[model samples]
Target: MDKYKQYFLKNIRKKLEEWETVPSISHNEVYRFLHSIAGTASIIGFDEIGSKARKLMNQLNETDDKQWTIEEVKQYLFEIIEWFDENKKDAPVSFTDKGNKYGDKPVILLIDDDTSFLMYMKEQLEKVGWYVAAIANPQKAITSFYDVRPDCVVIDIHMKETDGFAVLEFLKEKLKQQFIPTIMVSVDSSKAVRIKSYEMGADDFIQKPFDLDEFIVRVKRQLERKKHIDEMLLLDELTHVYNRKYLKQAYALLQSDWQRSQEPFCLAVLDLDHFKQVNDRYGHLVGDVVLREFARFLKQGTRVSDIIVRFGGEEFVILFPKTRREEASEVVNRLREQFECHSFREGGTAFSRTFSCGVVEITDANEPLEHWLRLADNALYEAKENGRNRVVSATPSQEAVHQKIIKIAVVDDDPIMRTIITDIVTKLPCERKTKHELQTFKDGVEFIASNWHREHSPCLVILDGVMPKMDGLEVLQWIRQQKRSDRYKVIMLTSRRSENDIARALELGADDYITKPFKLLELEARICQMMKRMS
Candidate 1:
């Protein structure tokens, strides 16, 4: 024990035990006492004690004078006090704090059937500050990749459950869209394997039994490149606000949060009034300056929670998350007034320009983005008609925008898998022209028994191959025999080593086949692609 150990233990023990005998303590007092211990214990070399003290301190709710009973205090600090009693005789063996477990490190999805190698690689990666999601079964590659959303993927070429090629093939679409780095690994460093892997959309290739440092360097290199690509893909070049591509995605996520929490959010369309006049009088270069200054003004003027995007020339969109329509409208009005007062100087031409804004609260979770845009656009047109520099809040229409609602059926016996797919579907970037309707069934019989298949609207069925009381193949056959012409798109989810079943599924009119333990992004991409095909 350090010379300070006795002093530390005497003070910590007395402070903690005081809670047990005292009738109560103020929340602020308890917080201050824990803070004192946390700060002092670590400095004196009782690191664990300090760490634990901080954890207990975090549990305290801040208040001016709220009282906490002994029971409530003990609930949080029992471990801290107990540690002091047990460790009075000995200090915790000198230790190192290896950071919070996988704290914000780049996540890597590693697929290898070799358990020993997987464990070793995972340990090595974690040691170097990489979070590795290692899966032995290739079947789980799909599900884990989708759920984990790893920054990189390292997959072994050889596996009994499913080969690395199949995983790569399914993940190809996602890799193209996201540019997620994928590394193919194998004992064979043959040229053919390397070529084949690259052809399958593998971003990098590594031979097994290679130097660990080299492997990490290669993975890090790809991650660096991906970061650059991500920045380029997400932001507008001139305005530096989010681009149009990002708006649809952000809107979908906002809708998802609204559906879950019912928290209010508003969508607004903003156009600089008479922007063309500025561009014509001044050159395009001057026009660029006005746009950049406008974006800067909006960013500086609005709350950080609001999202500003350059929705294409002179047109900008802002998402006021967690703000009601009335409040957002007021904010937009304030911004409009503030912007009108600002002057843009292009070579001593000091001219002031005003903007027109149309804002609407997102009321319907099911409304397509265009519906919201149209509502805001109509209001924007009204603002232009009324006056150039003004803000307008659109009245909610009772009539809902109608689109083809494609039934997305997940017929899986496993409830967990069903829930995962259903959840992921909410995040899928579907074609704006069509909205999706999701349904889940336990077995093939249950799915077929329902009138979903008989619905007049186009339907996409994600049918599982194996199920009790009528399997996926049987369901596929029944779907094919239906009187409705190819309005139905079915993606068969088959188990591993189902070659005959795969062939049979295709023969029975399955639109696509994905082996089980599928990657999530692949499934989402497949669904999105098949949806396009159906349209």
Candidate 2:
């Protein structure tokens, strides 16, 4: 039998004998003792003993008759003893040696001033093949931890020279490795003590006279969880691909190699076609699944050397090392075909997926990173315009086409409403006429404060009413007071239908009032009319 199981059985027998003599013992006390035994036995793989102890504990809890005689208590204890004796012969193989499988077990530094109790725990833990360094002195524990570089530390809350809480504070300050998990073990079972231990940066806690099974379970669980968390930091939760953060780190190393070898590389940008429409029609949950499955397809289709990354929502970027434009185009073409054929099903409804791609080959030494990225982005734009679900390459002739500039300003407190207006403006012909420079402000106060100067002005201002910092009418009044520019025009965009709000905006020299969710064409025509008037 495992030594921990034997220890647990001994404790169970002791609790049973106590209950036999004092039949009036609180049910909670008896339950706690049996629960501890059951938890420990299960941890060490003493299934039979653990199962019987759990059943007896349940029976004790369910007995509502308060008038139980002493004879009844003795009979129950005898039955439990007999049950353990019968199952002891059939118990499964204990996990006494499994700790060694971890390969160079991490030393656990256990600090407790109770010398006898600390020794008992250390012996029990070490019997299961765990490397334990026990110390009755807090100062000695710190030295041992530094010498051994223990993976974890357990400190008792009460000690002679210093308390466990103090020792924990010392470790947190002195141990430069904050990632090391620390646990506090104490007989102080009060909620306040547990909360205080947590505040002191203890990862976990256990009451004194801890069940050996629970101790091992908690230790193993914490170590495994830490390992898994470290791995997940490198992965993107949405697409399950390596995130751009990881890509940037890996690209730095690859860039050095390219600089030394004078090798060529290609960077491709991929964007889902009409992805917003998918979110609008199917909701974000389905859209998320589509993105995940699409990412998986990209992973399966790409070469092992290629680095794929989720740039942001509905957009992905891939780095093809030592690949030329033609090779990258072939890879993109395959991916495009695969996506066109892919159908995602949500709630028994199927939807087809398509994506547009742009590729740029890094060949010129003078080309800046932003310049190449812009080239690819422009190519992607062309692909989207010329019926998406295709690939476009950056050509020198196409790169010569100048992007028109339009200076637009939006004043809205609600971020979502501002985004909606910005989206509409980006799709307008004015965007193509003026290479789009758009600015958004949360409130009218921010707009007036930032754009008070004559040189700092936008061609058109989309203003909102009923704002907290400053109302649209107040902003228009301020603007009229300054007489800043004749070129500037204001459009009042609001959700309010109040005639008073509309009349005030126009009375304060506002050009127009557009209600929420206004038609895109109407908004464009209104702006063009104002522009013509100014001209």
Candidate 1: list runs displaced more than 4 Å. 1-86, 89-102, 235-535
**Candidate 1 at 34: error in angstroms?**
29
- The candidate that wins on lDDT is 1
Which pairs of residues have clashing backbones in candidate 2?
Answer: 186-208, 404-434, 404-435, 405-434, 405-435, 406-434, 406-435
Candidate 2's error at 85, in angstroms? 99
> What is the lDDT of every predicted structure here?
0.75, 0.67
Candidate 1 similarity to native, TM-score = 0.35
Q: TM per model?
A: 0.35, 0.38
Candidate 1 shows a clash count of: 6
Off by over 4 Å in 2: 1-234, 365-367, 400-535
